[model samples]
Target: MKNILNNVVSLIVVMIVLLLIIPLSPFFLDVMIILNIAVSLIILLVSMNIKEALEFSIFPSLLLITTLYRIGINISSTRSILSNSGTAGQVIQSMGDFVLQGNVVVGVIIFLIIVLVQFLVITKGAERVAEVAARFTLDAMPGKQMAIDADLGSGLITEDEAKERRYKIQKEADFYGSMDGATKIVKGDATMSLIITAVNFLGGCVIGMVQGTMGFTEVLQVYSIATIGDGLVSQIPALLISTATGMIVTRAVAEDSLNIDVTRQFGAQPKAIMIAGGVLAILIAIPGMPKFQLAVIALTMMLGGWYLLRRMEEFSRVPEPAMAPGGGMSPTDIEQMQMEDEENFKDINSVYDLLSVEPIEMEFGYSLIPLVDEASGGRMIDRIVIFRRQYAQEMGLVIPSIRLRDSSSLNTNQYVIKIKGEEVAKGEILVDYYLALEPPNLEKEIDGIDTIEPAYGIPSKWITVDKKEMAEIYGYTVIDPLSVMLTHLSETVKKHAHELLNRPEVVRLVENMKRQAPELVEELIPQLISYGNFQKILTNLLKEGIPIKDMETIMETIVDSSMTVRDLDSITENIRVALKRTITRKFCEGNSMRVVTLDAELEKTIITSLTNGDHGVYLALSPEVMQGVITQMTEEVRKFQELGQVPIILTSQVVRVHFYRLVEQFFPDVFVLSFNEISNNIQIQAVGNIAV
Candidate 1:
């Protein structure tokens, strides 16, 4: 029964089209005319009440269908009028007599005015709006798709939600595109109505005089009234539909309907209303004004303004309920007292919430809010998501979701990056400007605000967007604020990647490995070494910027050596030797590896200072010698950096860990590798040496 009922409208539309050829009686024609008016009114009301355009996505199709119906009605009425000389329907006769009032010229003029208004003003405006809307909606699709993907990648929204959002974007584009073409159909319908009305007047006059035995003047009078009435009946509905189309295309998405929004906005300012009332009163008091009519309108406006002000005052005077002394309260305060009672209820495990911290966080100033807001066309969050995926593939570590939020207390242009609840890096950027890095060996000076680049602290300047081309022409590296922030965030995450690894992450990594090599994981864990020791070995490698993507090699090496190696550092060294190829490839350039080697005497001294006990290996170097080693290492590292190479210190296996510990405090960015970790296939080049 429900399915049949749903198909009834389709059947009626088919019949409406068929009516273009079929003849209709006077009563049936009247009923169809009334039905057309009712449908048009309903459509207008629905268009006005909808909160969003999508809620009435089917409106374009309905517009086409209704236009067809109106044309079909015109055809049916034209057939009846020409054959019967204005005796088609009492409704048409009554309409013609009432509107024309025995004046054919006035009736025709009024009908032409209605047609001109719809075609020239309403239809043309709607068509242009629909065209522009379709173009913009289609253009915005890619950005909207990226936003959905970003939300899904960041875990801010579920997969289903992302799919739904994407579908909605596509639907919106389709709706506007259809409306663009559908508006043309409406314009064509208006043109056709004009032609049909003219045909009815001229054709009816010829038939009335030639066949109906009526004089020429009488024929003109009768046909003009009938033609104008017919045009009125059709064009009035067309005007309504056109207006509805305009409203649909121009409506902005809001929380309320059009009527409510207009009322709220217009009534928001009582002072404006009062001023308008005052101006009206002044005009009424002047001479030659309609005093009574102006006075009534002025009085109404003043009264409305006064009422609004009084209501606002009443709202302001409503006081918040305060707690009574000794927990005593009146009956009027029972609701507030009950709310307080609910607030006192606490869960037993609520304390666990305090123990959790985000692995990575970025707090941006209020000025940068648009960088993360998808609606504002900001792609920073999307770029961050892409960076996270790429960083994971390069570093072989699953970075946790970085929580982004706005900070009100920070400077408007500043942003802070944190890891494990501690601020690690912060920088300032101009939201509307671009950062242009100084080109290599360039002597030309550019006009801009001189500031250092936040990512790498290179010499850079903040330049206006219009100067971007000029900077690029000079071979300067231009980057947007979002890219600058992401670069800083990427480097900071890499530097602190070791800190992000914990027991849960370690377990997740092991579980991932078990899928590929179950026997290796089983043999390396519980039997030879504990999970905590293995995690520590991984952490130690990561601390020096090593990737553990070669899980098979690491697991096999650990399984082979864990039976004899009890110290975590010893196990780590053994694993590094097994991963010599990976480590060498990471730090070496092509077939040769450039390194800063320690002097033989200093190496021997470091080996002697290393003492092994129950706690682990410890470097017991004197303060004087440690200071000297740090000073020399800093100089060597600086030289490597100047040559555009990462600083890598190579030493023998026995003293490698101790040397790393000694230099790590002073040069945290340096890579410390043991001789055993260097692959024999790669050639070694000692670029510089550190002597103490």
Candidate 2:
């Protein structure tokens, strides 16, 4: 409403000036026209332009004023001068006197002349100025026609030159430069450029003239960066705009720590923000949009740059502060970033955030378990109870974290070992295991040496892997050398006898050894009966294809067969059920059906769907009907061949000639019950008789 009111008042005032003021005061009108035209033309010519001669912009207004002024002066001066003398001074004096006289038509004419001269001067100057700008910017940024590359390679250029090379190369590739160092991206295609340029030029010429004539210089200067008539008017506007934009950018982004952090979090660089802003600003200056304000574009772009900067800053970091120690707020600083970027920046952060952690249970030997701790140094084992739980939500890892998972606590849910009888079971099955005495150290580890190093010589690292080293390091009396001669005098031998103690004879023999070599028997018993060696031997034998199946079969028989449930038995049953399921699945998959009803009945129903005797596609069977038809097919195949054809019967018994004694043995009784019989079902006839 306000805009409408302002426009109405402005139009009414212009109307009053045209009707009452202009006609009554023609001398003032003439003076106003002459002054406006001259001022506009001078601005357009001297302004230099915004690199290109943007059409319908400030330049056109300036041009219009010049052209109108020139035409006006010519007509008015000639009218007065031609009325008497032909000389230059006489003409000037007469023209000046008539122009001072109250002639409204003469004033309009003077306005037209000034406008024409301004228009011509502007166009000529602007075109030259644009060409010069393009040339200079191109020359300054040229990678070619330079010895800089070779000089740098030879260490001739300074460090500054080397540093600048990267930026210069980028500039050369990415943008075009203006005199004020305004960089514009190479966007619009050639066809678009041509159309926009033409529209803009025509608009500039026409509107520049209108505004100039209407005495709207303030509007022209406010909107236009540079004009065709007067170059100086453009400077204030451009500088003011740049300063305004710069201030806006600072206000929006400077104190917003959250926005800045977001930018940092997302790995955004300063260069990226600057580039976005710069492109936006350039777009402001290049409004080739027809019938639009090409003049006010510079302002729009500056604001756009500030907007982009603000957004980019927001997405780069975590806005929330981390909790401090001692249950209090940390005296940490809000992380501030320089407007500039750093060296070697790739702009990515891994472990972007940790979403949550919760206790999880994993399946262990005989129970579901919650893991309290686990330790495996330098080993990576990701499982159900690991960070798989932690990362159920995305870690949003952009770059990999430098930290590795720490493993220092022992918290396995269970430690399970299987025990077998003297003759092992042929098939795997879980059973109650008898306690077995065994040496724990004979397991062949990569760092597992069978011989124990002296306590003083072995490093602590060895103790973790080697039990003997651990024992020696701890200085345990369990390592007595004289225990080798004893039967079961020491603890090691006593424990070794535990598995054999199920029988009375073995216990008596071990008891005798305990009485004999008390020291030696304790240390020696562990080396003889460990399951690790048996497992290794079993593994080797299986790999070598040795028959270990007999031993498993005998041992499996030793336990009550009802109590001895093997894993494979259940697995094999499942496999058989699975195979049965697959067979049923195959039959169920396709269009095969067992016939229980006559096809004639189905045909009748299908025929009723279409017009009498008129055939179209018919989905001729319901599921029950299809099953009935399949049954019929099976019956028909069985009946075929006293060689007739329902299928299976025709090929029921295939007799190929077998060779015996180098002679053809065409024994009809010799048959393989197979689909081979069906292939012999007579080549499918390729006609409908086999089955539709």
Candidate 3:
């Protein structure tokens, strides 16, 4: 039944077009004219009631159909008038008589004025707005798409929601583009109305004079009335539709219809209404004004203003609900409300809610909430998005979404970063100040609160906003509090990225890899190295800050060595050697790889402490020797820091793991490399030696 009705609407549209060639009787012409007026009225109402432009997305096509219908009506009526001796439909004839009131000149002028308004003002303005809208929507598509993808990647929106939003954006672009062309149709329709009206008047006069039915003056009066009437009847509906088009294109999206929005906005301020009433009262008292009429209007205005003010006062005076005896509510109302509240709480805050924890979490003090509040212009979320992409590109790791929340128990300036539900790092940042690091060549020290850079522990000071420029001019590195926190979070995530990669992520990686190199993954998985061991190797590499983006190389190395190397550590070491060029480039500065080599005696001592067992290699050195080694290594590391270089310790392949195990607890930032991990093509610059 619905389809049949839709087909009927389609048939009617076709018939409207065919009416341009087929002549119709006066009664049929009248009915079609009324139908055209009804449609224009409906369009105007719908346009006004829509909450958004897309709600009436088919309006552009409807505009074309309605314009054609109006033109066809005009053509049929003009034919009846010229051929049937100015005897057209009563609707057009009545409209002409009522508008002219026996004055042909006045009616003609009014008809032309309506056409001019529709063409020059409404249609033209709508066209320009649609053109601009279409252009901007097209231009912003790329950025909008990126934002949607970012939201999807961050898990802020589900895949289905993202797809729907993308489709809506494309639909909006297409709608506006169509409207840009639809406005031209309206302009042409208005232009044609003028031509048709002129032809009706002139041609009717010629026919009447040739038939010798009336004098020149009589012919002029009769035909002018008919022509002006026909033009007015058609132009009135055209004008309404043109107005609707303007309204739809220019309408801003709101929660309510046009009428409701207008009312709410205009009545929001009772004081303004009262002021208007006072002005109306003053105008009513003016001597030259119509005293009775002005007085009545002033009284109505004053009454409306008083009503609004009283309502506002009453609303403001509404008291909060009072508690019953014992600081509780009454048994009936309070108990029911309490029960509902408990049920709602249980629904959301159940044991199931505690089962999941974000891989990375950031808890900030209450005062730092503004840093993540988008409404307050906080860009921390955007910065995090950028950080994720940067991490993916540089480190070849997909960091999970960092859950941000506020903690009132924390101090006003403190923030804590957590990995897998355990706190790993904490820092304090002054929200309104900038941290300025002093350069070595600084002539004088700036006066501020001395502190350490949160990310790197470099000595710094928190300076006020006014001193930022002076600090920069003095070659001090200045950073805002948000950037400081972001940098710290990014570095922390990179350092602990291995813990974030679990079996599921590894499986996903494998599935993705299979798409590119099916044969390699198919042969290696479950045949050479199990999936568990594969994940272990990747995690081991990430633990040492090696990018696994070169998956082909990693897989090839594993497939080649896993047959003989069953020990996971030995396999990892072998893979590291396979990636010698990559590791060398990472640690090297240009052609020279500056490093600190362990002393021969210390290396031998560490090697002697190593024990091979069922689990893996173990290091067991005396506490005194370990302490002495840590002290010596700390001194060598400081020298590299003073030279503004990252410290890299080199050792023989056999003792590299043992030495790394011993020193990592003391200096986590130091890079320890085995001799086999360095490429022969690079120059080795031994800056210092770690001796004990």
| Candidate number of the best TM-score | 1
Candidate 3 ranges beyond 4 A from true positions: 1-95, 105-147, 154-161, 173-234, 250-356, 443-449, 514-532, 580-592, 598-608, 621-629, 675-684
Residues 378-454 of candidate 1 have per-residue lDDT tens digits of 88777877787777777678778888999998999999999988899999989999999997677677788999987
What's the ranking of the predictions by TM-score, best on top? 1, 3, 2
* TM-score attained by model 3: 0.72
lDDT of 3 by residue, 1-692 (tens): 98988799699888988999999999999999998899999999998999888999999989989998998999899999999888898998898889989988888888889899999999899889888888988997876776787798777899899999999999988998998899999989989998999999999999999985789998998898899989988998999999999888877457778888888876667777777767877886667888787767777777787888888788789676767788877687777889998997788667578788779999999888889887787879878888898888877778888899999889989999999999999999899999998786777778789999988888899999999998898889999999999999998999899999989888878888999999999998989988899999999899888888888889998888877878877777888898898898888888888889988998888878888787888998898988888888888898888888888999988787667767888888888899899988888989888775
Task: Note the clash tally of each candidate.
Answer: 0, 85, 0
Q: TM-scores for all candidates?
A: 0.74, 0.17, 0.72
Give me the runs in candidate 2 sitting further than 4 Å from their true place. 1-37, 49-58, 84-692
Better-scoring candidate (TM-score), 1 or 2: 1
Model 2, 27-61: lDDT tens digits are: 54345334544454445333322222221123323
In model 3, the clashing pairs are: none
Candidate with the larger lDDT of 2 and 3: 3
Which one wins by TM-score: 2 or 3? 3
Worst 10 residues of 2 by lDDT: 655-664
